[model samples]
Target chain A: MELKVYVDRLSQPSRAIVIFCKVNKIDFEEVGIELLKGQHLTPEFKEINPMGKVPAIVVDGKFKLFESHAILIFLASAFPGVADHWYPADLYRRAEIHSILDWHHSNLRHGSSFTYFPFPHELCSDETNVFQLNASSAGFIQNTLLAPLFGRSLNPQAAAEAEKVLSSSLSKIEALWLKESGQFLLGSSQPSIADLCLVCEIMQLEFADETDRNRILGPHKKIQQWIEDTKSATKPHFDEVHQTLFAAKVKLQMQRK
Target chain B: MELKVYVDRLSQPSRAIVIFCKVNKIDFEEVGIELLKGQHLTPEFKEINPMGKVPAIVVDGKFKLFESHAILIFLASAFPGVADHWYPADLYRRAEIHSILDWHHSNLRHGSSFTYFPFPHELCSDETNVFQLNASSAGFIQNTLLAPLFGRSLNPQAAAEAEKVLSSSLSKIEALWLKESGQFLLGSSQPSIADLCLVCEIMQLEFADETDRNRILGPHKKIQQWIEDTKSATKPHFDEVHQTLFAAKVKLQMQRK
Candidate 1:
């Protein structure tokens, strides 16, 4: 039996895993957990991942793994001969990649919070539905959803605060981290899993209001170009996996119309 | 010539490196960076590490590496024969370690924020002196120093807030991650680098007020025992490297008296 990859395409990490598996041609079954529908909360999914988070995998029907970084490393190591570049063999280079991934959790990953908090109402059909959705879920409601933002209304100050955080995050990436890497981080010719993790994160900004997205990402040219370069390098796999996000955006636009 | 580890023992991650190197008997020269004196701000140190953080290593006096997680992994891979359990050979186990390290940055590691923000006054001798220290520095001041905390006064609300964050963090570790581990995470008889990282982080909470420390750590009996076990496992090396923090705490207590 092939490995089972449980993911919700709308989740950034999920998209990265799908892209990785597809680009590397790793044999796996893709199981979708729709976050919007609370499918991840189902007991069956809970049995697979007690954390109720996507981007989890069960390998060979035995070992269960969560955390996108771990999952990426597992896939890379398990299929080393095939997917060598996603994770490198060189000790120092691989360390740099590891450092980037670790640093990412607090830094660039803040983009997720900034993206959702600014425009939560727009993410769902209506405010009532958003609250009802949260009410139905047991335990904690997942972040980056509409419910958390309902406690605080959207205002200029909130937008500015989010922009400040998002911009600072992007600036650190541009100034501090990517100076060595011309096109990709750590100077890799091909995109690494770090690149996938970051691009997917920045892509979340697209789900934000257009004004906020441009304000936050507009000043950082290097980051914008790096995102494009990562996409171009990855090509069809990148586009294919991200279609869900694109579809959601189009649907939101139609709803507004 | 040996690998050079630049560190300030007061820093949690820096202490982890010192303990790791000493325990493993890795041939490395310990280069001290006096964070309290603004040594990290010097242009010379900046050339070595622009980020101005300690726990950086220069291998063979050439390739410079930063980020304690990266440095730990680099040491593990470079000297694999010496310390096997620190980072395991088993792919799944290593992946779990990676996940913990990555999860740490946002979860348990937020202890840094809670620790410093709660006790701003006792950290320095005087407010004027703290400003002078910051003004003299050419670069950013190191964390766990008196400067950043000096600006904010201690309050019950701050302590409560820190406790809330800290408690929520500890609960997740107890309920979710450590289900499989016997004494150490991942069920190893010996503690891994994940143990070093986490224990070092929790140790920082000790610097908080006794009341705050009890409130923060009191509920989690397993975590407290794990800390003791990790200390026992690491032993004299752990005590030796932590001397600086211990002294600082003593000084703070004396001042309060």
Candidate 2:
């Protein structure tokens, strides 16, 4: 099956999907949709994902799918060589992972830079124009990093609020999911898609100034270790896919300096 | 196998799970954890769900699970008699449903009464006290309805903002998911858990005044029909499970009168 993966590495979920594909050795073609340049808003990209978001996939040029978590599940279940631990086959264990994934969407992911972005007009825009607002506009990452990159003023109140949500999400991961022994979330020996998705989300904080990032992430020791563990388990692919994001971080830092 | 469901009918996902079980003829005992009373915050409930949210379940007195989408998936997969239409066996079809489910959590659900609730200090609270703020404080439903229930004055600005987000979410559902040919979401002949979860979420808007609800929901004609179709397909159980919500709506209306 020919799988065409549409992604923008700057987007957290996009990076997770790329890393998953690479680690699992899934044969796929990567098509970039740059969010910063408004590439994702093009009419051509709309056909692939009417949502006009990145981290979409087209399978064998027939079936199309969006939403990174769903794509990850599809890849894990459909691919033959993907290790079972990535998405376990046992019904109960799989359900637990689903809980985490869903929680992440509403809780951690929402609190992150993704949904917290303020797009006042998009809220009331027509179908053609709705949600055209990029997520990188006004969230935690944007407030700390992207705001400067885009020549926008930081909203300190919004940033503080987003940080609280993100920190609470991290604390939940540490207290509820992280085990005393296991390196990965849900206390599993191997990292699951939830780990990759959430860690990749937290990794975006790297774009923030070192002081700000540390202040936000410093309290979550278990989460810190889990990120390292997830990065290690995924190997070169994790760092490889994140190269774009890290490069962006360095560029942003240099600009700040 | 024995199943115990802990829920509060006031919570959207909790109602969805209850309705799903009732419609599917799943034998499960319902345990109420009232949100207004802050019952979910108790330590006993925390044992069942560390997140302290509702619609959690325990199977045969051993296995525990939370998050409505995950619980629905578990129930659909684990139960013998559940129809395939609710959650299809095909991997691709299932992934499509997952896409919708995840999208609902971040979009419709977030913009609704759940996440938009402003909990100022909860943002910085420790793990022991985090997220204790109830959802029915400052969202579309809360701002339009429940704010008065707790004697809290409505914040018109926040309500208008939430309405914009909620309306945009509804527009996306109408534009992207609902089809001209089918009565159910994703153009399916039968209702899926995605339909149940999302419909239940929209159903909460019934609490708002008639004019406010109409002004918001009136624009989305297809969504209106689809809600009715889903209700019809699910038969008595749909209305049965929603009786509490509808009753609350009537009471809130009477209070206004």
Candidate 3:
């Protein structure tokens, strides 16, 4: 049996995984576990990934694995002939890539929180919160304390707080990551999985209102260009996989009306 | 030139890096970045690691790298002849290890927050807060709102909340990781760096009040044993490197009096 990869294009990590597979031409079956539909939470999917998260895979129909960064490394390592720059053997280059990927978890990936919150969850038991269903991954934050406080519209205080957190994180990226060189992180000519991992995260801002998105991304010219560079490098696969994001944006817009 | 590693052993990630180098017999110089004294914050050291964090290495005195997980992987990948199990060639095993390490950044590593919050940053602000000085990391968290709220003593509300977060993280370890047959995580019999990264995090709980630590750790028998098993596998390096933890505990006790 061929390797089977489970993902939802709605997820940033999942989009990275799909693009990596497609760019590298790694043959595998794509299994979509729609997070908004609560598909990942099902008992059946739990057998594949107990954590109920996405970007998980089954190798040869038996071995199971999760975590998008790990999966990216595994694919690159397992299929070395496909591309060296993605995860190069040069020890220092690989180490630099490793450093960024590890840091991405708490840092740049905070985009998940910045974009997710400010939207409503179940506002009250009696009133089925339409925003909860309409909101994407950030709504899954499980902050029961703040859920009731945020009604249909964005919570101003929470939105400001989220923007602060996101801005600091972005500033660090612009200051620390971009300093090295070139079109991508670590100054590499080709965009590595690290590039994919982070660019996909920045791509999530598309779900937010244009004003909020601009507020978060506007200052960082390098990051904006890096995203474009990553897009061009990945080609049709990048736009194709992110089609779901456009769809979500349209749906969220319709709900706003 | 030999590899130069910057560390302050009081930091858990630094301790793990020290232990990895010692066990692997990787020749290097250990440059202690005195966090307690605000050494890492200095302009000179900032040149080495812009993040101002420890457990960074200057490979061959030129190429600099940070983040302990990445450093550990670098050592394993760079010097594969030392031991295969540290980071094996088998794709699935490596993937599983990668999964655990990534999960660790957010989950198991939360112990740092739980253990460190009760201490004041300026117990003797004039004297440089050496315990705070020696404490290389906990200060790195910029949650000023939560910091003031925690006060000098363990806030019951915060401690209870911390316990809830920690217990949930540990339960996942017991349920998902310990299920494998070996003594270590994944039941491989040999402890991997994934084992080192996590066990080191748990070991930091040595700083927490015994009551609070026990409250959080009590139910997880398998995890406790795994900690011991990881210690035994790593042997002298684990104990020797962790001596700093014991000394810090003594200092914290003195402050309590």
Top DockQ model: 2
Give the higher-TM-score candidate: 1 or 3: 3
TM-score of each: 0.83, 0.89, 0.86
TM-score of chain B of each: 0.84, 0.87, 0.86
* Candidate 1 per-residue C-alpha lDDT over A90-176 given as tens digits, one digit per residue, 9 for 90 to 100: 887898888787666754564334433223322321111111222111101123233344463334443444455557778877877
Query: After superposing candidate 3, which stretches have Cα over 4 Å from the reference?
Result: A117-158, B115-155
Mind giving the per-residue lDDT tens digits that candidate 3 earns over A1-257? Answer: 37789888877788899999999999889998866666777899889988777878898889888888998998888875568989887888888998998877655554344433233333211001112322212222223223444453444544454456567777887888777778888778888888998888778777767776786688988889999999999998999999998987787667555
User: Candidate 3, clashing residue pairs?
Assistant: A116-A138, B36-B133, B36-B134, B129-B133, B130-B133, B130-B134, B182-B187
Clashing pairs in 1: B181-B187
Complex DockQ per candidate: 0.38, 0.58, 0.53
Candidate 2 accuracy as lDDT: 0.76
Better of 1 and 2 by TM-score: 2
Candidate 2, residue A15: the lDDT equals 88
Assess each prediction's global lDDT (C-alpha) against the native: 0.68, 0.76, 0.71
Please report how far candidate 3 places residue B151 from its true position, in Å: 4.3
